[model samples]
Structure formats: C-alpha cells, structure tokens
Target chain A: MLKVIAQDFIRHEFLETVRPLYQELVEKTRQEKECVSYHLFTDQKDPGYFIFIEEWPDRAALDAHCQTEHFRRLVPLIDSYQTREGTFLLMDAFSAAADS
Target chain B: MLKVIAQDFIRHEFLETVRPLYQELVEKTRQEKECVSYHLFTDQKDPGYFIFIEEWPDRAALDAHCQTEHFRRLVPLIDSYQTREGTFLLMDAFSAAADS
Candidate 1:
C-alpha cells in the first residue's frame, strides 16, 4: 500500500476562510480511485494546525490521483495557506502483518 | 508497525527561519526507538509545502514519543506558522503483507 500524509500550520486568523476549501478537497479526494479514506482533523491541543491522511492501493493509482483536476485546483488554494509554511510527505509503505 | 504522517504548509518567506527547527526535529525523532525512518520532503511540484513521515515499532512507542519533551517543543514552534491555516492527521495502519 501507499500512504501519503501532510500537516499544515495555517494562520489561525484565516481558519474560517479556509474551511470551504478544505471541505471541497476532502470530498473530491474521497471520490477518487484507490482513495480508501481521506479526512481532515484538527489538533485538539493545537488549534490552527491540520492533518490530511490518504491511503492508496498502490503508488501508480496515487500518482494518477495527483494529476486529477481536483488536485490541480486544490494545490493552488492549499498553497495560499503557505503564507506561513506547511509540508508535504510522500511515503512508500511495507507491512509485515496484514491480518494480525 | 505503526505509521504517522503530517504535512506543514510553511510560509515560503519563513522557510529559512524554520530550517534549524526542522533539522533539530529530524535528529531528535531519528534517535527514538520505533522510528524505522523519518524524512522531510518537499513537493517537487509545489514549493513551501513540506511532508513528514514517521514509522514506529508499535503504537505504545508512538504514544511515548508524543509525550516526550521533543514533541512538546515541536508542537509550539510549528503552531507559530498558523498564520494561514493547516492540518494534522492520525491514522491506524493495517498491513496485509509486511514480509511481502
């Protein structure tokens, strides 16, 4: 499986303005293939920071999703939040005990 | 194994200011027991966005890491970037084939 994770340290003052964009991207990612799950969660301990988790059947499928129109539009808006700074992570996963 | 991922959309302008902080973190996390590997990567397609991937031996070790002093300090400095808006993700991983 392929797992991709990212956390954004957004400006707290702009939190309300970004909610609609967050909601739109979440909905769009869920509709894609290999997207087993996608969610946006806030840190109870950290108010403005958010995390995004996505799981894919394999890397190729994940690559395809990255090229989608939703991804294209989402990237720019997401970048807008980079007014402060954020990060992106790409991970290749190997699991030892699937049924454990 | 346990997997944890996060992405931070750092302000492009402050990217250099956060470099020392990022380096300090990579070293600290690398020394932990469950950390098979942790890397900070930039999106080739996007600038100013960063991703973090962490793998642990199990959940217990991960839980401990969270309570560690490194985590306490890391959280606050990271939150300072919330000038725009960001995210955090917590995932429970189930693998079908670890030795595959």
Candidate 2:
C-alpha cells in the first residue's frame, strides 16, 4: 500500500473559493477503484492550510489519479492558491500487532 | 473529536533507538478508551522521519493521554531524537458525501 500525505498552505484569501473544489475532488477521488481512502483536513487555527491524507493500492493507482480530468482541472487551481506547490511525503505504514 | 497530525524529523542516528519506543507507545495509546485511532508512518524517502496520525474523542481524552505513564516516559525520548521539536497541527476533518 502507498500512503500519501500532502500539506498545502493556502493563501488566506482563497480559503472560501477552494473549499468547494476540494469537496468535489474528495468525492470524485474516493470513487476511483484504486483509492482505499481519501480524507481532507483543515488546520483548526488556520483554515487555509489543508492536509490530504490518502491511501492507494500502488504508485500506478496514484499516477492514474493525477491524470484524471478532475485532478487536472482542480489541482492547478488548488496549486495557484497555495503559497508553495505543497509538500508531498510518501510513507510506509507501521502498526503495533496489538492494535492491528 | 480532536485529530492531530505530528511530523517528526528524527536524527538518523536515533532511528533504531526510537523505533521500539514508538511501537510500544502506539500499542499502549490504542488501548486507551478515548483513543479513536492511532497510526504511525515513516517517510519512504527518509526513513528517519515519522508522521503520527491520531484521533481522540475530545480534549479531555487527549489531555489524559498526555498524562499516561507510557506517554510521559516515551515522548521525551522521542523528542530528544528530533532535529527540531517537530511540528504539530490540529485539524478538523472533512469528507465528501460519497464517502460519508
């Protein structure tokens, strides 16, 4: 499994404008066959900062997501609103056996 | 609910030392009545860096967690291994209707 954590610090002015777009992206992204989970979180202290935590079956699945029409359409606008392109960290998950 | 995303950049030298402590912490934390979920992830590109994603029923639950003997014992050691104290972000989660 591939876990992706993306931290996007958006310009305060764009918070309201981009929220709906994110809502749509989350909805559409979850329907993809490769998506295990897709969640969106906003910083409580700074609403403009959003974090996307997602799980995918593989890199190909994630790549396919990036190529989707909604991704292409929405991501650019989302990017434009950010102070930086955003930070993406790919991770390997670990869990204690007791919890697992 | 209170969701916490903590990013820790551990000193490469301390990776081996902290792994077991973290594992123990995760196990103990999940056993707490107020803990909704707890997950640990290590950055693929940088094994020394870790991200902890956690959920608690409320502030009291979180505060109680901070007071745990295991938490108190392990966290300081974990913090000592980091280059910087680490960045913690409190977030409000949002999900698409299709998902919910």
Candidate 3:
C-alpha cells in the first residue's frame, strides 16, 4: 500500500474559504474505487495548516486519483490560497504488521 | 482526539540500527490503553526519513504516553540517531465526518 502525507499551508485569512472545498475533495476522493482511506486534518496550533493522510493500493491508483475530475478542479483552486508550496511525502509502511 | 504526525530524519548509517528499536517501540505503544492507533512509515524515496502517524484519545493520553517506560527508554535513544530534530505536528480532524 502507499500512504501519502500531504501538507498545505494556507494563509490564515483563507482558512474558511478552503475548508468546504477540502471537504468536497475528500468526500469525492473517498468514493473512488482505488481510495482505501482519505482524511483531512488541521494543525491544532495553526488552523491554516492542513494535512491529508491518504491510502491507496499502489502508485498506479494514486496517479489515477490525481487525474480524477474532482482533483483537477479543486487542487489548483486550493493551491492558490497557500502561503507556501505544499509538501507531499509518498511513503510505505515501515513494518508489514502495520499494513494490516 | 489528538493526531500526531512526527517526522524523523535519521542518518543513513543509522537506518539499520534504528529499525529494530522503532519496531519495538511501535509494538509496545500499540498496547497502551490510551493509544487509539499508532503506525510508522518510511519515505518511499528517502529511506532515512520516517514518520509516525499516531492517534490518542486526548492530550492527556499523549502526555501519559511520553511518561511510559518504553517511550522514555526508546524515544531518546531513537532521537540520538536522528540527523536532525524531528518535527511533531499536533493536529485535529477538520471534519467530524472523517473521524469515523
């Protein structure tokens, strides 16, 4: 499985503006057959900082997700409000036991 | 609930040395009553980079986790092998729907 930790740092003023769109993106993404799980988290100290913890079966599934209509429509719009470039860490479970 | 995204940059030379310690830590931590979930991941492109995605019932549970014998014994030892100080982001779910 592939786990992605995507960090987005938005300007404080844009927090409310970006939240619903993120909810929409997450809801749409979760419906995809390739999506194992998709969740959104906001930093407790910095509400403007958001993180998406996602799981996919593999890289091919993840690549396909980026090409989906909702992704294309919402991601660029979401990026426009960012205070800085986002960070995406593509990772694998450190132990096989964790995969379960 | 509190979710912690911990990023650790380990020296490449210490990867082998740290793997078992991390495995031990994960195993022990999962047994804690306050631990909702705990999983470790390694960056796909950078073997030296590891992340711990942990969930606790609350801040008190997380604080108690730090006081545990296993945590006290292993975390500092684990930190010693880090190339740089780890990044710990305390986070909360953006949408209640995702918490399920």
Candidate 4:
C-alpha cells in the first residue's frame, strides 16, 4: 500500500472555517475505490495543528484522487488556512510474514 | 479520541527482526478495549523508516495500554532496532459537528 502523512497548522481564526472542508474531504476521499483509509487528527498540545494520514492501493490511485474535482477545489481553500505549506511524506510498507 | 503518530528508523539489518514484533504488537493492541485502530506504515523512499498511527478512546485507555505486559515487553525490543529515539506526537480529534 502507498501511504501519506501530511501536516498543517491552521490560522487561529480560520479553524472553524477549515473544519467543514476537512470533513467534506474526508467523507469524499473515503468513498474512492483506491482509498484504503483516511484520517484527520488535531494535536492535543496545539489546537491549530492538523495531521492527515491516508492509505491507497498505489501511486496511480493517489494520483487519480488528486485530479478529482473535490480535491482540486479543496486544495486552494486549505492553502489559505495554513501557517506554512503542509508537509507531505509518501511511504510504502515493508512486507512482513505477519502481513499474511 | 486520543491519537498518536510515532516514527522510527530501524537499522537496515534489523528490519527483518523487527517485523514479527510489530506484527505481534498490532495484533495484541487491536484486541485492547481502548483501541479504536492501529496502523503500521513504511516510507516509500526509505525502507528503514516506519510510522505508526493509533487511536484510543481516551488517555486513560492509552495509559493502561502502555502498562500492558505485551507492550512493556515489546518496547525494549523495538528500541534496539532503532537508529535514533522515535518521535511520538500526541493528538486529539476536533469535535466537529461532522463527528456526530
């Protein structure tokens, strides 16, 4: 599986505004055929910090997701709330005997 | 919910040795009453890099989790495989209307 871990820090005033967008994004992303799972979490120590962890079957699946209308639209709005450009880490899992 | 995002980079040779331990940990952790979910992921660029994303009902549950016999035994074994001390970021999910 292909996995991504992304982090963002929302502006203090924009928390409420950005949450619904995340909710909508999560709702839609989970419905995609390639999506294994998607989650949004906020830091306990920092209210503005948000992290998104997602899994997909492969790069093609993730690429297809980025091209979706909802994702294309959501990206610009999500950008406005950030303290900095978000960090995105792409990862692949090691196959273990236990995976079977 | 309480969430944790943890990262570790294992010595290249130790990857094989560590897999079963993580598998065991995931299996046992999932059986815990407090565990909502637990996931293990590896970085696409770096085979040695591992990330864990976990969720629990609350801090009390997580605290109890750490005290479990399996977890206590697993910690040291995991540590030996590490290139550096791991990072553990504690987080809480925002209570959006969407959560309802």
Ranking by DockQ: 4, 3, 2, 1
DockQ of each: 0.04, 0.49, 0.51, 0.59
TM-score of each: 0.47, 0.91, 0.93, 0.83
Q: Where does candidate 2 chain A have its weakest 10-residue lDDT segment? A: A91-100
Per prediction, fnat is 0.02, 0.77, 0.71, 0.77
**Model 3 segments more than 4 A misplaced:** A96-100, B96-100
Best by lDDT: 3
lDDT of 3 at B31: 96
Q: Pick the candidate with the highest TM-score.
A: 3
Total backbone collisions for each predicted model? 41, 0, 0, 3
lDDT (Cα, tens digit) per residue for candidate 1, span A19-61: 6777787888899867887766555455566667667787788
Worst 10 residues of 4 chain B by lDDT: B91-100
Model 4: colliding residue pairs: A91-B44, A92-B43, A92-B44
TM-score of 3: 0.93
Model 1 spans with C-alpha error above 4 angstroms: A92-100, B1-100
Q: Give the TM-score of candidate 4.
A: 0.83
- How do the residues B19-95 of candidate 3 rate in per-residue lDDT, one tens digit apiece? 88999999999999889999999998988899999999999999999999999999999999999999999999887
TM-score of chain A of 3: 0.93
* Model 2, docking class: medium
